[model samples]
Target chain A: MGGLTVNTKLLRQILVGFVRDEVYKVGVRKGVLGLSGGIDSALVAYIAAEALGPENVHAYCMPYRTSNPESEAHARLVAESLGIKFKVIEITPMIDAYFTLTPDADNMRRGNKMARERMTILYDHSAAVGGLVLGTSNKTELLLGYGTLHGDMASALNPIGDIYKSQVWALSEAMGVPSEVIEKKPSADLWAGQTDEQELGFTYREADELLYRMVDQRMSREELVAAGFDAAFIDNVARKVQGSHFKRRLPIIAKVSNRTIDRDFRYARDWGK
Target chain B: MDFTVALAQIKPKLGCLDDNMALAEAAIEKGIAAGADLVVFPELALTGYFLKDLVPEVALRLDSPQMEKLKKLSERISIAIGFVEVSADYRFFNSAVYLEAGEIRHVHRKVYLPTYGLFDEQRYMARGERFRAFDTRFGRIGMLICEDMWHLSAPYILAMDGAMTLICLSSSPGRGVTESEGLGSAAAWQKLTTTTAMFLNCRVFYCNRVGYEDGINFWGGSEAISPSGEMTDRGAILEEDFVLAKVDGGALRRERIFSPMMRDENLAITVKELKRIDREKDC
Candidate 1:
């Protein structure tokens, strides 16, 4: 979108390098990334495989009754293509049992339940296997408040949190993901006929381009509109980025002392005697 | 002569060359009004620190036209400022240039290149190997960069090399922590200043930068610590201002004579020998 500013291949290499170094530093032998049949998760699985090795990467596919069958099949195909260990678990029973115990559970409640359930399964499997849970949400989703908080957004470390969705597609192509996964209508597939563009009211290309110009380039709204983007589109994307700033930061805690955690407690991540 | 030192905890605009020079001029006027004999600014006060690759472009040659303007300003009051100094060979140094009576008296390049997180000084600056004390009318002053104060050897070496007072310029970032947190950068600053003063048994004038550049925010908490490790004056955190304090050369002499840490050659040898012993044990 708008002539990809960041090189996807280089971004992938950097992320893979960071992941590999972090794993080695922490002394973790394996890593698990959720394969959600979405391009982001699929790309993450591939990158994690490249970083930690196919044998060390475990791809978990959690499907509910509402989940499309083709989505599950595609996820399995991605895992197989990467030669990674794939596990399929049905979440319908878990959702049904929980809903039955608590009637009148709305869409918001159910959506949150599904997200937490998936994370619980991922973390449990990660703990059992002694691997870190890799995050799949990209920068676009993170910036626009598109991710389920503490659900898909939760991970031991995120490799693709800085890459936008358009960049994710470019990386997917470089990753040798199936063209279907790349070219297919982008979706979370939470419901039938659901697409991310249709829900967000803007295409990933537009959103990614606008977000890149806003965040990375730090361009003004007038500059963006002058650059040939619609004024309304610029306003909408700016609002989304501003509105979702909380998702990107740590919760601010009040300081009653001479030094605070975020301020004083900074040593280098690798700082040691 | 009665000496008053002003530590200018000023924020420098990153990459805005003209605006930064203007700010430096205004800060000098403020120091002169305060009747300060010497005004000390933070490290990289002229162009700003934490610049990724723009150091070479923004760095000034020692005898550049910009230094002439600073030299003119120095005629009013003795000025100590930090900036990137480009050598004839084109090597860049994080140097502290001291100007008095319209001439640069001494230029000290930083030796400690912090190559750790959020810092890539090693990539940009060549380390200075020699440590020397500057003879000033006020006292025998020594200059050091931010991380140089962290090592016990730096202040001790400066003192043994004939420095009666140590002046350290720092651009220490406000590592994402609140003022109340005991583990933050402010606490680290206090510990470093106190420990260095105690070890050297000399007064220390520490000047730190303020404001955010890139992802790191510099917390300006300049302070003057006496030889007894007491803070005589402390500047406000995250604000730009100057702190003026009178240095009692007699009190400093008394503290050193009472403690005798500076004159204890046997103690210094024992410490060095212990370190060598520890290294041999590890081997």
Candidate 2:
């Protein structure tokens, strides 16, 4: 039902301006991103380079010992092509030190730990280089709560958060990202032989259309089914989108006063005057 | 004379008067550079909408220094903008002003203070009673603030009072989505503006702001409609635009002669009917 496509040239200009303005408003022109060599990170890196010049953009390839080598190479390729600084930081030692204590740690725990650790590394690099952390999470992953909270989702600012995964692929191709990075199977690389589609049970194209109709179009489950979507599929996507709602917002503060921080004192992102 | 209006759909920071005025002045300069005869801003463009308790703090008197700066800008071109008006009685009104040649030409206080839904305007601001049109160098123009135009009678009264150009400043949030129409609010507003133009035989300028403020987002689909029920030009949706469009007085005259809706309207009969209904309602 959703056949939406973005004009890459126009989108590039808009996003580049968004990045520049949002960054400049905060009195900073430098940006740092945790590059996983996936389409999302690759796209963000390219845009950041375009917005803040290649000299001001920095990319870090934080991989675990068991992480795929292809991912690290792809991340390097992105940095090299954009003429931005690239660094490789292995999270194997840091992750294993904690996991060694908990012998029964599951794959989820390990993945979450890795995600948070990578964020820690990115933030540290951001401070060292005087750059803000650029978010790479797309709208589909953000809505579905696919990324770990406060881990992969943590950022000073996000340029592609409103874009869907399917749209991200299209934008990536249009932005001239490497063909290998665009064609590769999407993955979090939490463990060996792990892939995103296998874990989610549906391809991004299918889920993206479902999300576009449900969220953007505001179609109900019944309406979606009547429009020819599988009832169960629609229900599943709805549940995921609903369940992940908390990840999209700030932590709720108990409001005992008239001007509670996030409650009554909520202001625009650039309220510092 | 054919007048060109610069419909500036901009987002102003809430409770930040200095910044908002600076932005307004910049837009005015840009519009002047674009050869516009008049420039229009969104409702409460100076103080921002949803002020709540901050209304009185940010409210400006007609002689306030901020308004003096705005008046100085109007020395170059006609300026139409919205702000909270602090009266001599110390009451505030959600108001729009038409400033020209370093003077306050006209002001229209918002008659309808929408209290229900997301708006709490009635809680903080007093309602205005009069709807008047005033003469400018370009033409006789009327100003309505946001919800005032939502009520049909506001524009109708202005049209009857000899306003040939209707300027509406709105801070309306985007809501509702149907398959046929992308944004329901935008579609509804388009119909309202175009119908008002066709029925009143006047040019309509609808200026809406864009940006997120306190959770509610103002969708900017500002447009200029001709007297012939045609959308002459429109601004970008959810983006800032400083665009100018020509309004032909000749076309307006031709449309008035062709349709003659205003000429055919029997105001005395309608007033008599309304008065009789009021009297007979006791039965």
Candidate 3:
């Protein structure tokens, strides 16, 4: 089966062009991206470097106490290999300080804080360096509602988002990312020993295959199951995709006018060129 | 020169900037395979339209490093796409970026901010103040957002600025309307497109988004019109696909010669003055 092969070279060029064009047009030169040490961030860093050059790409590793040390090392390794500037800021003390102040914070709330903390750091650096935060999440993560809003999901521009986990591996390999980074078990490193498959209860290969069939192909449950996917797995994935749909869209505004932005306010980017 | 353009009708996940760019790349590849010299995508194609609060967070500055990828993609074919452009002062506007020959040729921000109904654009997007046409290899082309087509001044400004072709990118919702409504709506939309083509004595290209996101379904009715006020080519509505059409730039000159609409100063002057008065009133 010839699945949609994301052209990594093309993808990198496109990302680089996106950043460089925006920078050249608007006159901003630097950029920042959260370095999670996962395949997503690894790929994003490489693309940003290609787009803005290593001198311009700033990779920040915001690790909490709960975050695995291995992931931090991996993030550093990727940043160093690419010759991009890197920084490691531990979020444990800050997260602890916030929790100390708001003791009622639950896991979900704390997770959100962690995500937001990373964003604050990225944006602050962005201001100081005149850069935009590049996003690192993938389509699978976005569809699964796997990321915290305004946290890991935040970015001024994302280059690898369309690539599924499986496809990210393909592109990472093409971009010469180390096998260790590409082949490692996927995790957000949000907590110690927190593998993405373990927490989500599905492997990237399985999830991406299912998602490719469902989203890219728009196959129904019966069709997917008939193709030999487990019925429960299909339902679970579908439910996740459905549940997290809101995160994938703009806030619905009630239409009450002659020309709505998403409706009638249509114009080409180079309409008057 | 005859310009063959493709309007890519795609479904983009909001906030999924990378994926949206990938989709755009795929669309361009398709367009190139079909021999298109330029490809146009829906407004905010990179970041996805309808990003409410996320617009500020995800909005890209016009000169952000993210657009380098698109610029490289333009090495072979010209591309135009829309995104949330944040300025130096942190004000955000809905803007389009034009890429050709490995460079960003121009950036046009949407001027009209629709606040009512399903649009809180005014809440998040700052209105654009400038309107002008740019010179391209194809010809002098004009750009506008979806709602900009409704205003008489947008096309007028482009024409006054000496545009020979007008292109509009849109993400118009279907709004639970029926087929009959769509037919009527299409007629109305076609009238607007044709009117602009006729008024400017220039060809027009309009592309719309197609797909259901939340409750708002984007009805894709991408089309291309000749200067003679004829729908030369149109894309499918409410579907994910692209429309390819060959437009003869020479046809504009020929059509203008045949129709003499460009020389009709009586009504054109009044319309231009009325638009100027309205713009002055707003100021």
Per-candidate TM equals 0.53, 0.82, 0.51
lDDT of 3 by residue, A218-271 (tens): 898889989999999998988998998887765777889987866655542312
For each prediction in turn, the share of the native Cα contacts (below 8 Å between chains A and B) that it retains comes to 0.00, 0.03, 0.00
Per-residue error at B234 for model 2, in Å? Answer: 6.2
Which model scores highest in lDDT? Answer: 2
Residue range with the least summed lDDT across 10 consecutive positions in model 3 chain A: A264-273
Per-residue lDDT of A1-273 in model 2, one digit per residue for the tens?
334466566556556766765676567779999999899999999899998999999899999999999999999999899999988999999999999899799999989999999999999988898888999999999999999998999998888887788878888998889999999999999878899999999999899988988887788788898889998888898899999899998898888988988566644455532
Residue B24 error for model 3, in Å? 24
> B131-206, model 1: which lDDT tens digit per residue?
7898887778899899998877788778888887899999997642221333267788898898788877878899
Which scores higher on lDDT, 1 or 3?
1
Question: Model 2 residue B65 lDDT?
Answer: 96
In model 2, chain B matches the true chain B with a TM-score of 0.97
Model 3 bad stretches (over 4 Å): A253-273, B1-283
Off by over 4 Å in 2: A3-14, B2-15, B26-37, B47-57, B72-76, B86-94, B110-132, B145-157, B170-196, B206-225, B229-248, B265-283
What is the full ranking by TM-score, best candidate first?
2, 1, 3
Query: What TM-score does chain B of candidate 1 reach?
Result: 0.91
lDDT of 1 by residue, A1-273 (tens): 444544454455456765765665556878987888878889988888898899999889998888888899889989999999999988889998999988898876787788778999999999889898988888899999887778888887788887778778878898899888888887776778888899999899888878878887789888998889999888887888788788777788798887677554432332210
Instruction: Compute the lDDT for candidate 1.
Output: 0.81
Task: Report per-candidate DockQ.
Answer: 0.02, 0.10, 0.01
- Please give the distance, in angstroms, between residue A269's alpha carbon in candidate 2 and its true position after superposition: 2.3
lDDT of 2: 0.86
